[model samples]
Target: MSKKVMFLAHEGVGLGHIARTCKIANHLSEKNMCLVVTGSREAAWLLKRSVDFVKLPSLDGLITERARYLGTKLYFDRGDEKAIRFRKTLAEETARHFAPDIIFIDHTFTGKGGEYKDLLLRSGSEIFIVLRPVLGTREESVRHIFGNLGADLIPVLQPKVLVAGDARTSTSSDDVRSFFPTIPIEHVGYLAGPGERTNPSARPYNILCSSGSGFDGEVLSYAMCELAEKQPDISITLIVGPRGSNPPAAPPNVEVILETHSIHQQLERAQLVVCHGGYNSVIEAMSHHLPIVVFLGDGVDPIARDERRIHSRLLSSHYPLLVCEDVKELPQAIHSSRELPAADTYPNALVVNGLANIGNLVATASPAKASDFVVTPIDRTGDG
Candidate 1:
């Protein structure tokens, strides 16, 4: 039996939220009918064929700081009620027709401006919120999960939360519990899917550089260009995401992929990875046990900046990676990171079975048990 599951992923400064939802949707689509209603500008091409997609009016242009970061003009501010009403109506209308068995709201609960709050509360479907820590306040999360309606709607709606990180590294699950003790919260690992791995001996001694979504990838773009100029003998591939401005001119040795559906293919050949500390990028690199050098950018968005800072700090402690804050130090970081040996197997510091864990959550809603699809990952050290 195929159950209808809908995911609502509102766009932020980057594509992290939508990319996270898409990974889960792709995993569950084999057993369920998945429809993703997202506000991400790149949803049309970013999603896989297994999942269906619908795009909402983007709020990217309305965000002044984001607009400034992207070098675009802003027409309005957050108080535009007309924009809110339009998005709310569009999303609600889609939900009324789709009639999903489960609705997963990613990151922001209120949509851009109270768009999904009322829709989520009034809808009879099972509600699940996909949250990442250090993004929003607990008070706001409480308000979004359980509005002023008290415990009356708890039984009828039965809203739950799915934290998109591991409990061992992140305090998100504990943080959410302090606010809503009764709300069912599960740490579904890193919300990243498994990727292909290549043999260490067969791979080239090259570097793969990426800034997720390219929204704030300018710093990385500049640094890579300089690195390429300085290191002419080395080969570099830079993936510039579609949503932002074009990066600086690259040398012949640097290959720039503007957009692509298959990053796993690129991951297959690279010996090292240099990236911004986005969740998707880091987790994907870690799954391959590739030596990563994180170039932490100081951006205009405080929440996004803090997210990168915290995630990089947490990963650097356990994994074999270096977190470099300055672009000047990026070359040295890269040189040092390349010498770091690849782990014989996946690191046990974090859970990489996020796709399997999410499948279990969807199976709970249907007649089938997700255990049929879940595979428990083994924990091991580099020596073993």
Candidate 2:
């Protein structure tokens, strides 16, 4: 029997979460029918053809930036009221029409006191699963509150499984297990994999750096210029995602491509990757067995700290990933990463097994069986 699955991805933030969800949905779609509901028009457009999508209200601009800044400090203000109502209505409508066998929520905790929480709780018999990144700590008290809300709401919402998409070494999973021990933790390895192409342009020594919409281009350009001055022989390709508002000019040896689909293609032949410590970029580079030079920009955002933490862990693991704090150090980092021998350290089998497990779990768990699940709140007070 074809199990009906709905994947809910929130928008107005970096494309990481949505991109990860899409990858999972694409894989799952092979065995079952999958639907993606997202608030990001850009992500929806990017994924519309590959997967079924339900577009919600667009929450673009600084609001998305603010959410990234605050981390778990998710608060519902007047602006959120309309979003809340819309999400609830949409959730209900989706449930009524799709009659999904299972519901998977990416990143967002739907069962907590939010509008979606009420809808999920009221949905009656559907198995609501929370698909999250490896767990981590947040600076906000509200995050704890919401964590508790999520923990409590899970039983009420009756999720048959909890899927944690991250490596075993991932701190995010540690945090999740610590908070919600009762919830079964299924570790799906890193969501990123070898993209569509294995061959990029034939360039002897080309570096690829990606700054998803939020990064300061001036800072990146300056750093790239410094690297170019030191390694004149190396060509660099800087990709500013489609939504990059202000891109800076690059040095002569460097090419700045705005919103190009050639990223994966480029990654195939690149000698090294210099990018923000986004999970997708790092994992994709690893998938291609390319060394990475991660720039953890400490801009006004909570994600900065998160990125720094993730990079720190990766560096500690001796994964040929160099973390650069200031632009002054970027040149050295790039040089160091390029010099390292190419090796594939990414765990490809782990990801495949996890996906298979999740598919089987979804297929076996009855949407009508609500009594087989347990939920608990994640304690926010603990020092993660």
Candidate 3:
């Protein structure tokens, strides 16, 4: 029956990857065997205690701006070779021992800079790439310089099928086909609970500032806090991720939550959501049909710009969004959205019940043909 499933989630630089990985794991039928391995320090928080979860060394350190610059310096010089090697070895060992029937890699095609590429090739299990609802196509310099060429170096370059955790209407298959043209895709909906009724009258705050991980929104946080301080009458709730916790004083109207497991509760209570434009964040906000303002970043991180920009094009009259480039323009967007009527809530926009859909896709899905598996030597050092 090939019921065993193994999920390899990239190290927790952001909450979206691990969060969506575990969400799918939790929904799988109880009869199936499932194992998840992740590098985020928040691994325990990411998955339920019942699921078999292994925590590995985080690879976030190696995927930063500094690591992208490939000049006279060696690959090891750009990244923490120690951490990268350790994670690769641990992941390989874990997957080898588990001997899964199928493998699900969430977002990171090149795990720890091509760590999983070797593992994916050697493992007998069929592998699938789990993509977020919206896979950003905007290429960064690093993607152009290394992303395309690097895929060729990986042995099992193609996934058996791509499972998208978003509704088909929210994102077109064409968006991702450009990335993996031949691979088939299954839309399993946004990996979250259903949308709640919008009670603008009952909303806890007029402006809700949310993000995936606490890691990335320092400048946004500071600016939001400054905005709140400037405008005390307008209420704001910041659902700070692991990185952006510990905001300034509450100032009566402003509230800061350290981190929450499910953002649905807070999202339903928000009249306007100012978020980091993560796939999960945008989908959740849109599900609630609230006015949205997406934050790209402070220009320090390249990923901020290209990663979230692709979905901005999907914003339509039915789902109007205020794309915030800088904090200076945020207050104006918030004010403008406040005047606009609450957008129509499409509760069924995404497939909320995913276990059956995902199970059917994984169980009956065909493994790639023999030609798909090309022989390639393992890059044990993880430098390549």
Candidate 4:
């Protein structure tokens, strides 16, 4: 018999959580029943109907903004209060009908603002939480470590089984393990998802500029547009979030995709990438052996700024990606990166067999026994 699986993903600030959930769903769809429930406004676009998807509706009190809820973990009336109730309703609806055997949650410790407290009882399914290691102590994660007199907003959602998405090679799984010392976890290698690794080529599109989310994407898009307008000789492509974000118009020389679901395809074809540092973005870019020019948000949105910068510094040390503190510094960085020889180009060091590992995990999963399954990846060579 086929199993029923549901994934609960939150937008938080960037689309990384939603994107990660969607990638896992792809591995499950062919054999098991897969359903994805998300709160992102661009859910339809990002998910791209890759599997059975449920987009939470916008309610009056709970129409949320990333700034109010993402970092502080406090629900401000930026209108998404109904989001909590929405999560409960969606979970209940899925439980009532779909009857999942396993519920895989991405990043979100709690159901919809952690309001879906009784999810285990309601669904009667094993819970799995998958997250990447965000290095450095931020005030929000720090607050969750030490308790406050109910004033502390962000709650660390513990899982019955934690899956840390780090491989032994590129990332230090030990540091990831330290973050959740109490939880039983298994190393599942990289989180590039399915079909994200591609062969590198000397493509015509030389530069690809992207910002992962809708809010901050516009800033990067406009910057790229200005750069493209000035330099007609160099080919450029900008992936601003969705059509709703209204990416700046590009010159005839530049190609702008409102959004491209296939991250690997775009990155492999490009010679270099310019993006804000998000976990999945960094992984995918590196997986395709593309050099990255990391730029933090312009500080327009505090939540976005923090979200973009969260794991950037830690990654710069291990990965070959270059970090640019200022946007104006991007042109010279991109030019300098091109000057490097073939041997100097950063090879795709982070190998991913995430989908195969996940499949092996599901096959060995015991319904009566909930235990950590340390994934032994099938192949370590170049996302093969």
Candidate 5:
């Protein structure tokens, strides 16, 4: 039987929310009717032909350049209520009509600004809250998890919590369990983007620098340009996301592409990976067993910014990962990372096959049975 799965992805700063949902939806779409209701215009463009999608009035533009630079506040100025209300109305209406069997709410429990709180209270759909690996402080995580759940919806709406990244490499799992002991939690491995896995072959590019959706990637991208200038012998491919900050110039050895539809193709040819610590980018790099250097920029919000710091610290335990807090340190970090061997011996648990694990859980349709979905070891025989 085909199940109706509705994914609510409220894209705030970057494409992480929608990108994760779309990856799950694309995998589930083969045997299910998947509908992705998101605030991201990029959702429809990224979704497969089988999956249906709808866009709502987005609050993504509310963050100003100063806010992104400061990485502290999120301001919704005057007259933004109209758009907010309209978005709320459209979201509610879509849920009512779709009447999905399963609703996967990305990141937040009640959606942005509690827009989906009413839906959680009224909808008959089985609810699931999908979370990223590294959520901010424990206090903020508690707020996002329980803030909008009033007395009325507390016992009634028992949604299963699913972490999109592996628990072994993620920092939020223990904190989340400590906050809500009884809440059912599942760590469903790294959900890389929708594409065939890159062939485990020798890559031609010496370094591949990428910042997801480049909304706040100015520092990293520009630093890479400077590195390219200093190291004329190194071959670098720089991808400043479509919405990302662009470097003014690049040396002959560095190839600067404005955007790419398939980043995995580029990943196949890279020897070392240097990028901002976005979930997708980090996971994909790990999947390829490449040496990773993450530059934690002040992105979108304080929580998001801190999450990168936590991400770099936690994930480094599992892979040959290095962190750079400032762009000034990036070149040296990259140099240090290059001498390290590929993480071919890195544990195979939770680094790849997230699409399969998540798909199995959805197919079972019973969260209790998720205990059987444990990490199985994989062979890395041919992968160089």
Candidate 6:
């Protein structure tokens, strides 16, 4: 019988979680049935062509850096009892009807107050996969709180894999084993795979930046304007993803592409990528061997913490990627990064082989037995 995989993603804040989930779903879709359940209509829309998606209406809370609730920083609205109830009902209904063999959950531990957990545990013998980025201390504290909640709400639950995107950056397998001792940890490499390679001769300089609507776009707009002023000769391509975050009025030197599907092609020829530290964009930059300057935004989502941590670690490892906390410093970072050599890019073969291994593991294992599968991290040569 064919395996059924359900991807449960919380679209409360940024597009990173759902975007990563979509990539995994696309990879797994060739052999298994994939269904994506998300709260962000924009995320669903962005991913609709690649995978099957179901949109769950969200509480529509604006995320700010200073917000907090229940000792956790609020990425989305925390106290919408009615929306939570409605989402919970919908999740339960979906799980009950679909009866998936495995469920992949992104960032959200409780699924709006233990709703999906309740359904999965009661259903029995279903594999749960938790996808997360490698986090630092502050974010780990928040994850611990959510993990505690999951343990309390569903005692029997054990995730089959805690897929970390930063596995390539980890010092050792112990780095991952330390956090998820009960379940196996897999370093799935960067979530963004090899996209279409563009002709290198096409553009002298291509700058790709995306903030999925709201405040992120505003910040990116400011950063892009700064870059355009400093480097007037470079050709700038700004892609605004479907959240309708318009780019600021650009100087004649810059060309803004709104909601463009050709980002992969653009990134292929770009000398530099200026982005909001989103998972998909950052990895896409790395996959294409482009130097990146990431601007960390203070959004109301825990996923932003993941972005910041990933960027911080990348900087520490001298990965040739720079993070701009102050948008004013973007141009300088870009200039400095331009001087550095491109970091060692992961081979396409490695990514394909790794993902194929994951699919094979999922296919061969029984739902209840999947949790025991361990993934050995791929060894990449070079310091960066």
Query: Which segments of candidate 2 are over 4 A away from where they belong?
Result: 48-50, 61-79, 111-113, 124-148, 158-167, 195-202, 215-218, 315-318, 345-357, 367-384
Per-model TM-score on C-alpha atoms? 0.84, 0.79, 0.77, 0.75, 0.85, 0.78
CA lDDT of 180 in candidate 3?
Answer: 52
Native-referenced Cα lDDT, model 3: 0.64
Better of 4 and 5 by lDDT: 5
Ranking by lDDT: 5, 1, 3, 6, 2, 4
**Model 4 ranges with Cα > 4 A deviation:** 41-50, 59-83, 135-139, 142-164, 167-180, 193-205, 243-249, 263-265, 300-310, 339-348, 368-384
lDDT of 2 at 12: 30
Write model 1 residue lDDT over 253-326, tens digit each, in one string: 78888877768878888878898878788877877778788887775255566667776777666677788888
lDDT measured at residue 376 in model 2 versus the true structure, 0 to 100: 26
Please give, for residues 16-40, the per-residue lDDT of candidate 6 as tens digits. Answer: 6676777677788887887888876
**1-384: candidate 5 lDDT, tens digit per residue:** 677788988675677788888888988999888999887888866889999898875565543453464354444554444445556677877877777778888877776567677766666677788888888788877676566553235457777888888777776677777866777888877875444333434544478898788877887877888888887878788888877755777788888887776677777778778887888788778766677998887644567778888888888877789998877788789888866655755665445567888777778783222222222222334433
Among the numbered candidates, top TM-score falls to: 5
Q: Better model by TM-score, 1 or 3?
A: 1
Clash pairs, model 5 backbone: 214-244
Candidate 6 minimal-lDDT segment of 10 residues: 62-71
RMSD of each: 10.3, 7.1, 5.3, 9.6, 10.3, 9.7
- Local error of candidate 1 at residue 290 (angstroms): 1.4
Candidate 4 per-residue lDDT over residues 75-141, each given as its tens digit: 4353444445545666666555666677787754564455444454445566676655552344454
Name every residue pair that clashes in candidate 4: 62-79, 62-80, 62-81, 62-82, 63-79, 63-80, 64-80
Find the 10 residues in a row with the least total lDDT in model 5: 367-376
Instruction: Single out the weakest 10-residue window by summed lDDT for candidate 1.
Output: 370-379
TM-score of 1: 0.84
Worst-scoring 10-residue span by lDDT in model 2: 374-383
